[model samples]
Target: MPMRLTKLLGIELPITQAPMAGVQGHALTVAVSNAGGLGSLPCAMLSADALRNELTAISRQ
Candidate 1:
């Protein structure tokens, strides 16, 4: 396949998993990243502390 945004993001594919807060699971991001797609996480709606925690979790994985 041709290069796409996913490749720009350092992934192997051009498909990204849509992130939905309170709906889609955070694990979805890791899964999509593993699959070469850009994994996304919805944290814009979270508070500063919550966002920090979420980022820490991501960093750990």
Candidate 2:
């Protein structure tokens, strides 16, 4: 059967990285994305400017 999760998430693999607040940042998210898995960014603890910066960094990768 086709991998439904991969199809739904638009990722090459079915793997998904859980958002790790304080332990992970945009770099890790980008790395997982580049590796063809679904990566998560934890924004619950971030300020608006910090979130914007993280997004910008992720977009640059």
lDDT of 1 by residue, 1-61 (tens): 5485655678787787888998765578877887888889898788888878777877778
Number of the top-ranking candidate, with lDDT as the measure: 2
Model 1: pairs clashing at backbone N, Cα or C within 3 Å: none
Give me the runs in candidate 2 sitting further than 4 Å from their true place: none
lDDT of 2 by residue, 1-61 (tens): 3498788889998888999999999999999999999989999999999999999999999
Best by TM-score: 2
User: What is the C-alpha local distance difference test score of candidate 1?
Assistant: 0.78
How much is the lDDT of residue 13 in candidate 2? 89
